[model samples]
Target: MNSTHDTSRHIGVHIDRPVQEVYAYTSDPTNLPAWARGLAGAVEKVGDQWVATASALGRVVVSFAPPNEFGVLDHDVTLPSGVTIYNPLRVIADGTGSEVVFTLRRQPEMTDAEFERDAGAVADDLARLRDLLESEG
Candidate 1:
């Protein structure tokens, strides 16, 4: 496998809240700061685009897919270097609870260690999301 090729890691968590609730909470970019620490805790809309003011990747533009009843929460994060990263996410019904899954894509330029770190960050974010939803619901 070429080290410069892209890959992905699927990180997920189970929240005691309903799938609809989980989808509603996470699909809103404004609620990101409370759970996703990777954004450095701030985001705002710049005209039509949602921009994260501070992040490990610096200020980035985030664009999400149109809301639907299928629990799709895919988004694109455009980094400072003009690189756009696609993130795939979903909130699925699991009996009375829900399962949130985030697919972290490994950039072609990222080293092995960097990819692992990004994966870890994603796991942490999902864990936080679980805590927030399960506790507050």
Candidate 2:
């Protein structure tokens, strides 16, 4: 099978900490809002999962993981134009800091502006994570 990064989106940030430390924090669903400022409030728990709200999308439940992989359930979220998309988030450690990758295939369609916005959000989150980890160390 093709690697997820082949067709999916990718972003990375290098925190001045051990890979294990960054991975532990990023892989925890509850700490997502700490890095992703767009999340309005604390993530809501469903069953045993926690839901993270994306800026343009509604609630997204991230699956539980220890340190390496973190994923959000693929589900349709409406856009302003009434279009929908199923976006799944994949996060892992790269050397030291964590790398966050998102997989999105157009449902109605995809736009450069939308992709840019999403990419910007991801980048900002990673930058914040790096800053926080480094400062704490």
Best by lDDT: 1
Question: Which digits, one per residue and each the tens of the lDDT, describe model 2 over residues 24-93?
Answer: 6665557767776754245667786566676545655544433333433233334444554455555455
What does candidate 1's lDDT look like per residue over 1-137, in tens digits?
22654477788898999899999999999998899888647989889999886656789999999999999999988889998988899999999999999988877767888888888888998999999988896
C-alpha displacement of 53 in model 1, angstroms?
2.3
TM for every model, in the order presented, reads: 0.92, 0.63
Clash-forming residue pairs, model 2: none
* Alpha-carbon lDDT, every model: 0.87, 0.57
- The model with the greatest TM-score is 1
Estimate the lDDT of model 2: 0.57
Cα-based lDDT at residue 45, candidate 1: 87
